[model samples]
Target: MEKYTHLGVYGVLVRDDHILLIQKARGPHKGKWDLPGGSIEFGEEPELTLQREFIEETGLAPITGNIRTAVSYTIIYQYDVNQMEELHHIGIIYDVELLDDQAVLRTDGDGQDSLGAKWIPLETLGLLPLTPFVEMIMEPAVQEESDVGMGTEVEG
Candidate 1:
């Protein structure tokens, strides 16, 4: 059986009551809403990867700060329908912030992987077609707010 491992880094940009998200245009999660980040290049630091990805996907620079690694997880999926190749995806999630709140959307650079980036309301996240990783990452945050009865008020 063919097998491969894909390592990716993602940024979570929460501002006000919204979170930045990209509508994937390619890959296994195409057509789904996901965080604005992508695969880590060889010899690249995870932090740099997150920053580069943010610029590539959203056309906005990430505000330099204490980028915190929030979580890491793995997902398994079929890479090939006929060859039985399995893809093991390892994801790193980071909490990040953008330099500007009103950055206009751009479709250049690595944005080809996605339709575009936009701010999604946190309250309506449950209604979007999100990738499994995004859904998993947001669950705790949602639960925490509900547990405290504070509602969704995402803050940077």
Candidate 2:
């Protein structure tokens, strides 16, 4: 088994009972709905990483936000025929506010991990495939419904 860790900056942008989310194009959370943000580059500040990733993933530029909390998760999965990896992912979450909530978002893939960004109704979150990080951010009821079990829970 291989062990690795990832530290990323994420943003939670909620507006009028809806939350902004991006579709993961790769990784353990591929094909799931996840918050906007990603790995911080070397020499890049967390806040700057948040801003850069937010734009890269969502395409709604000219925004501001602040750190809300820090969250972590651990998952072990197989990436190849006989390869197993234990990934410890740490997220620095931010409370982001868009200047133009009504502005159009980039729905196409960002040519990277994001398939696109969309505003998902809070009430409908449970009905969709969500990353563990998103589930941790959701209400208690939704959290309970998530696949958080022994040695398999996604959040810490």
Candidate 3:
């Protein structure tokens, strides 16, 4: 068996009580909901990767603010029927505000990885099949904000 480690940066775009999510069109989590992000290109900074990916997946440029490393985990994905690779995913969840809240779902530009983007109510996330990392980080991210009594407020 061969193993591979994949490093990805993700954004947690929250507005009101809804979070922006993309429906995966390919890869291990195809057909599942996932954060707006992807694997970082070689020599690309994680922050840049987050920015690029957010736009690519959502079709809206993210007004990024305080970015923090949210969570890291390793999972085995069987890309082929008999081939499993260890994916070490490092998620850098950014506080992002969209330039246009009314931006409709787009598959143009670099948004091919996802079928489309939608704002889903945070509470109803469980109803969707979310990527493992998104599922793992959602609770703590929400809890952390609630704990501070600071709801979604994007800086700049």
Predicted model with the maximum TM-score: 2
Top of the candidates by lDDT:
2
- Across residues 6-112, which tens digit of lDDT does each residue of candidate 2 receive? 99999998877678999999888889999999999999999889889988988887678888889999999886789989999999989897887666788896989
Clashing pairs in 2: none
Candidate 1 weakest lDDT stretch, 10 residues: 65-74
lDDT score for residue 86 of model 1: 53
Off by over 4 Å in 2: 140-156
Please give each candidate's TM-score: 0.79, 0.86, 0.79
Q: Per-residue lDDT tens digits of candidate 1, residues 54-152?
A: 878888774543555454444454545655545666678877766776766665435478788888888789999998778978887766656556655
**Superposition error at 96 for model 2 (Å):** 0.2
Cand. 1 Cα-lDDT: 0.75
Instruction: Give candidate 3 regions above 4 Å deviation.
Output: 100-111, 141-156
Q: Per-model C-alpha lDDT, please?
A: 0.75, 0.86, 0.76
Which of the predicted structures, 2 or 3, would earn the higher lDDT when compared with the native? 2
Cα-based lDDT at residue 131, candidate 1:
87
Clash pairs (backbone) in predicted model 1:
none
Summed backbone clashes in each candidate are 0, 0, 0
